[model samples]
Target: MEGQVVMGLQKLRVMIGSTTAIGLRALARLPHGTRLIGLAASYPVIERWLRALLCVYQPFPDIETATKYIRRFIPAGHEHSDVVSQLKQFADVTRESDYPVLFYLSGYAPGLSRVFDLGGGIGNLFYPYDRELRLPATLRWMVHDLPDKEEIVLQFAQSRHENRIGFSRRMEDASGVDLFIVSGALHYFEDELAVILARLAELPRLVVVNRTPFSRADPIVTTQVGDGYVHACKLHSLAATIAGMEAVGYRLVARWPVHERASRVPLRPDLNDTYWGLFFVLEADRRRRDASL
Candidate 1:
């Protein structure tokens, strides 16, 4: 009897999902359907219903609006103790997507001295990468994240007796750094890669953007809800990101898919996409050195 009930519930779930998809598709065919849906999305009641049904909320026009919505739930982001604790588990674990970053870091290790890890939580990648690649003795890795994370990161580093890893609250500290890494955190911000780098007095010669969600469709801001936490993320345009980096004198060295992470917007199957990792280097700097050679 219990086994029958379990199978029945699974069937029911599939039935409901299929029904919802069909209904949404049909509704989209009506005149002014898209406009009506957009207006309905603004209602808090609808938002709650969507959240309950799909585990995703309304698709905001931009990240700022989505961020405002999430703030009502989680004001401090990773600063929340539970979020931090959950993130700490990945400190020493490496994923398949990490190898690409490791490959590039290996090649750059000899000449690399400084690394700015934007939005890196508790120096997660530092420990695992160090274990695998045996980082340079003099390397200085700065983790740029929330001010509240500084203490937690410090404690973790101290416990591990990791002297090379440090914390910073300023993004400008990345100016003229040897390398800048953004792993699993770029979508949360509003700025493009070029815009962020342009603000720095000097750009890092090498940059790695890993575990980021990108879509071929137009940009969409969606909320990601996990156990006890919610975050606003914008699915960036793949072409626009690469073009923006190129316009700023950078070249795409390598790109790879990250199968472990993905994003799916409710009722928008067209916007569904997987995460990716990218590596970029300054073309002008390379050209200068080649010319000198």
Candidate 2:
């Protein structure tokens, strides 16, 4: 009897999913159907169907695929070649040039700081900053990633004998961190982004999100294929993302486009392909600290 009930539930889920998908595709053909469907349909239902559609068209054998592709595709010992290239370009800019990120950090975290780099991928962001800038003496950079990735970072840090850098496989180790840097990583944790944000008890004073894809229309989940591996990525809603941050006592201070990469939704070609970077600060805490300073 229990088995029968489980099978019935599964069947119902599939039926609802298929009907929702068909309705959405049908609505896409009409003149103003996209807007109408967005208003009428639930976001979760639509997102589920979008994932299903992507799987049918662009199947990924594994969702949690490793980043060993970086080694295979990118040159060895240059895992962060992309970031390094960007930094090299920035180096040509005059000292008077207004780089918002550098300016913001100078004003907000002028002194010694501790940074928790979530999904940092072998400390790519930190490597550039450490090599390029004269940071405070007491700076500590902690990178949180998968265990295998952590080992990779550890090896990299050891090779350089970097005392200021550390690695962790757990998010809880980020406690008391001053800055939380999340670059090109939120999409991979689409389902858990909200939960992870909400659970951060020791909220950082600053949060930096770079190369995150967002859509004004609706949230989309699609498979990204490259280097013979497939991984799921989500293009989330801009408004929804802002709201989630606001719920956690953070406010957007600045935002800019990441023009290096352009990506379109596989199912919905109408949406823009541009990605963006966002800087957020804990509003009340920042204001109080500023006043004190």
Candidate 3:
């Protein structure tokens, strides 16, 4: 498929370059399953990821609270870094939390996960997220991924959260749902980009973009989405993207660096470098439609 090929080419470069984010725009009129070959572009180094990683590695954000989110970290891949383990622990928590009733909304990532990951990926980072913060049995969760990535997410979603997933009718009106999560969604889109936001704008109390960036403090964190075969590609800045998110209803609620300690097999102790982790949660004020309305 064109999508697969494009992504493969992109990955090939990331294996050698600085940043990577999956994306491909499709027209509303395009027929289902139509493949669009993404001509490859030249790879470029964007040190944003590198700098962020180093900063967190040195003077890391306070991880005590992220510990409350012990459900995000898990079988942290590569070096079993604190961040990876914490994420895994976090996912494990989500698997057990009572915050169910998924407001399964979605959109494309702006090729950068600043505020959060908008759509799920087969990228399989959940393994680490689960190890960092284990999914809580006390919460009900909704997994958001693209249709192409659904079957896999569904398989995982069912194995963990089971049946409690959806924007339960009147849930927004129930004063407020415990938590509205975007978990691993929010990297494949741009500003004002969706039918999903308009809906989420009218529902859910809290939105946690578990996997995106938030760097308003700087303005140089941009990366080129290079094609494997093309000579060049456009560069996208992470700072600009977060600004767009604020423009919409989403406001920055909380942000912290994800970190974890070194470990054993349950943890991958071979981490090569510290990951530059950032997470942001957005809130939406929905209308309260009564049963009689």
Q: Indicate which candidate wins on TM-score.
A: 1
Per-model CA lDDT versus the true structure: 0.77, 0.61, 0.31
Q: Write the per-residue lDDT of candidate 3 for residues 3-64, one digit (tens) a residue.
A: 77875664554443332121111221145311221112111232343323322111112233
Q: Please list all clashing residue pairs in model 1, or write none if there are none.
A: none
Poorly placed runs, candidate 3 (over 4 Å): 1-140, 157-161, 165-178, 192-196, 199-201, 214-251, 259-293
Off by over 4 Å in 2: 1-99, 192-194, 285-293
Top lDDT prediction, candidate number: 1
Root-mean-square deviation of every model = 8.6, 10.2, 17.5
Q: Could you tally the backbone clashes for each prediction? A: 0, 0, 107
The parts of candidate 1 lying over 4 Å away from their true place are 1-56, 73-76, 286-293
lDDT per residue (tens digit) for residues 1-293 in model 1: 99778757644643454455446546655786545655665797885565445322546778877777656534445566677876788886887899999988787877788999998988888988888888888999999987887888889999999899999889989988889999999998877777788777777889999999987677778776655456888888878888888877789999998999777665554666789999999876532211110
